[model samples]
Target: MKKSLELLEFLGEPVSRDMKETLAHGSRQFRMSVHMTRVPSINNVVLYSHWHEELELLFLAKGSALFHIGQEKVTVRSGEVVFIPPNLLHSASRLDQEEIVFYAVLVHFNFLSSLENDQIQQQYILPIFMQNRRYPKLITREMDEELHIYPLLEEIRDAYQQESLGYELLVKAKLLEILYRLQKCAIHADADLDIGESRNSNSLQAKKVLAYVQQNYGKRITLADMAQHVNLSPAYFCRFMKKQFDLSPMDFLNEYRIAEAISLMETTDKKMTEIAELTGFCNVNRFTETFKNFYGCTPAYYRKAIRNHAGDGQHAVRCDTDLKSY
Candidate 1:
């Protein structure tokens, strides 16, 4: 338990909440960074959630892993990949013993000052992330064939190892190439996914409730509030939530609250007491107990572990290593 807490402290700290810092491996001026990390065991990580301010591209280079994005969970094995957007709570866990190997790149959409044009940013990036409310967030590869991201991964690996002059420039170019390929892949996969699927009208009420909760999680949200949002009575909404989401309304509310708490914990430097109140918990004791129940550690310890594990560099923000497989 202590070991897991330590790992979570390092990897699960939210990136956006507190004193936002740019990841150091890449040019801070560019709005993204890339790195490779290794862990001795999965328990050395924490099962917490966080989001980024830039688009995230995670390609499984080896082994298998599970990703939790909102209420949706998906598995990605070697040769598989996933896309996560800025400011969505998410986390990953290694699936098996062979150390999980993957290449990840965080891209700040309007990163370059030269490329901050509104039209280009909206055209190239907004379309991918803005329309995410209707679907469970995060994009995963659905095809059986492996995405040839490994070659690009290899190039990045080489540049890191060789460290010849201009290596960073080379890495930046390679990263862009990977993002372009991923964007193309996302458009293709999305088109295919839509063909066989019809909208789930039965879940319309649940969807509305989810959107409302996400928007208002930091405030005191009650069952009455959510029920009214979906035009259902509180009594029926309780049953409906159970039938649809496998959780009671209160449980769902707690999940959202804790999820928000986890994100704030990682990204911001706010004290645990303040975070507890900010995330809608009326009291610190109640908040601490609930947080530990969901995340398997006390909030203070969790924060401490993160500070301890992350190294002395600016960009060395660690990845989640302590979580059980989702």
Candidate 2:
């Protein structure tokens, strides 16, 4: 039996307080899970740079986004899927004003190789799993017609949404099918594997800067402090951040702080003042003012709404959705 019911975590709740994803997606027996991530129109930074040790499959369920993965950027449209290999620094921003909604399936390679099934693992899984082979970054409906990729992704979504018995097996089967098709596609596809040195350097710098923000967001952190920590002058840092993230350094800091505060509101019973202080606001009024600026609602109202409708929010409109422990 595949016992895969873990905490249902959406992107609103950061897996950890840091830049890196720290949530355990699934149980130890089966290291895979799915999440519905939503980005509101007012969100300045749709997502902060974060990396985890799991292979991620992202299905654009509703709207489009400008996805920054490592050094390269991909504009992913609705009804598309993006394959993100493990340990890649990635972020997203709304392409237009509409909110971006997507479902992310986080899986570990060990789950595929865990059962040994050695021949397939050695021949097919190892190279791609090790990032030795090139793979397609974007898959469209055309690829689905040709390779049936989208159908499998839909099956994964259906399995996760319904969460019936044997859903784990269903998800695993679809993921393995997708991986096999990806390997074959790479063998014949003229995909570019060279992500470039500039991209690699940018990814490192992004990680460093974002991690610094995560570590020190509770304390008063200045632009000069962040720039100096990353060894770039304040002016250079501002330009770099604007070019890379499409947001000013100060705006990004506030966005990140608000995201953390949102998580606290969703997961904890802390008072608004305590939450604000914990997230680095000078006072409760300041926190509420900024929160309204970012989310378009008072902290108290937002907290009440999220708490009241969390089980049936935009992310969980389906009745069979297993939002256990949400």
Candidate 3:
């Protein structure tokens, strides 16, 4: 069963002040807490999706992770870093190892709002967010080879740890360096890729449509109804989604429903009937049937299995669609 949109919204709120403070005391400034994580098995990294209004960067320092960024899923190896846009849905998990070590930086846009020069606004933000430019929006091209910036990342970490004499200024300087480096590489590398002709229009549309679905998942959404949200014809939306994700709109909705159901099952004790209705499914019987079909087990069994293994650590799961757990 899926959680109601209202409940999902509540669950997605940012970390509590107390929790944030707990993470802030150490060398890591909780601007966004940085962690070094290791899991005996990656299964604990259960697949779930959620979007945040803050930008996040994940750098694989010593292991590999399978990451789903929008409609694409790929393995990111050590030395590679991925930058995620604010409000984009993504999920990831380690592919192997008794443990994997990586560095993560979560940057709230407001933290850098003062640095938003006219040039940045003109070139990056407007074209992608406002004009809806249908492109990958590269942040770090040839990321596998960009090890020189590792020093800047380390500096940010150290400045937070030391907090001695103008540390805040130093941190900001390092952040600016990181951003400038990414922007410079993106511009040059994308030029070589010549993204004009080969860009995936359908995937771009799918992203927009998925955002709409997530915002309205608790409501009665249909194919024709969602198509109107993107101003694309119903038939076109259906065809485009199928080509882009290999699933029809309805199939995607079902996957989303199941994903939400999994989140609720793990986090709440709502009854199956209630979850079914909240997720937009009409009956528990139908919900169970669909859940079984997709996961090869009943929801109850799945929940119990997860409970038994909940303490192992955070392991990412296969992202059914883009909607993720916050």
Candidate 4:
């Protein structure tokens, strides 16, 4: 029997608090999360650019969106799947419609190799984790439709939703199949692999700057400080950051701070003034204006909406959902 959409959880919350380092996937046992998400409009950007340790598979079920991966931007239309390796910075924005729907499956590589000396770990997992092999970043239905990867994704989704007896075992088997197929495809498409070597130096520098920001977002940080941290001139750093993240250094900093403020608002009961000070905003007015601009609501209103929705037993705001105990 086909499960109704209402039975599938819809996750549209903001980015995770530790998104700069790793996305918390809401459980330690399974180390995976599956979500069906909807973006109501092009202006509604669901998640900011962030990176994590989990491998991500995103399937575009409807509409179109621009996916920014490192220095590249690709338009992911319906029926396409994008594969993101662990710890790569990426984000998505609506392209041409009032709404876009997508399904995401995030899995820690360790989940696929439960035993320390598992054969899968030796053959498939270690190469990618040890940086000895590379995989393609995006897989379009137009190109890979004949490959049957999309069908496997559908199977995984249905099995996850159905939650039949031994569903975890079924999901693990499907995930292994997907990984094997991806490895085969990557081997055949070696020339087209979007490997990390191309952006090795830049990625390191971006990580450095991001780390500095993560540690010092509460303090007044200057462009010169960040540039010096990355050993680039301010002008060069600006261009490099723009090329890497499609946002200026200051813009990225503000966005990061805003993300932190949103986390504070959702999880803590701190006053707006305190939240502002803690998130590095100068005053309540500036914080309110910036919050409204990014989230389309004042801090107070956003809090109220969250509170009202909190009592609803059917749904909860979560960065990631674990399917092991569902």
Q: Pick the candidate with the highest lDDT.
A: 2
User: What TM-score does candidate 1 get on C-alpha atoms?
Assistant: 0.50
Q: Write the per-residue lDDT of candidate 2 for residues 1-326, one digit (tens) a residue.
A: 22335434543334354467876667787677777666654444456678888888888877788888765578888888888878777787676767677777888888877476678886767755666665777787677667777678878877866778898788888888888778657752124345444555776788788878888899998999999987999999999898777779998898889878877776789999899999998999988998888767898887776655655554311111122222
When 1 and 4 are scored with TM-score, the better candidate is 4
Error of 1 at 112 (Å): 5.8
Q: Per-model C-alpha lDDT, please?
A: 0.58, 0.73, 0.56, 0.71
Task: Give the clash total for candidate 1.
Answer: 12
Clashing pairs in 3: 44-315, 45-315, 45-316, 46-315, 46-317, 47-317, 49-324, 49-325, 50-324
Better lDDT candidate (1, 3): 1
Better of 3 and 4 by lDDT: 4
* Model 1 RMSD vs true structure: 9.3
Instruction: Point out the higher-scoring one by lDDT: 1 or 2.
Output: 2
Each prediction's TM-score versus the true structure: 0.50, 0.72, 0.61, 0.72
Candidate 3: tens digits of C-alpha lDDT, residues 62-109: 667677655566677676666666555565655665455555566654
Error of 4 at 289 (Å): 5.4
lDDT of 1 at 157: 58
Ordered from best to worst lDDT, the candidate numbers read 2, 4, 1, 3
Instruction: Enumerate residue pairs that collide in model 2.
Output: none
- Cα displacement (angstroms), candidate 3, residue 311, comes to 6.5
Clashing pairs in 4: none
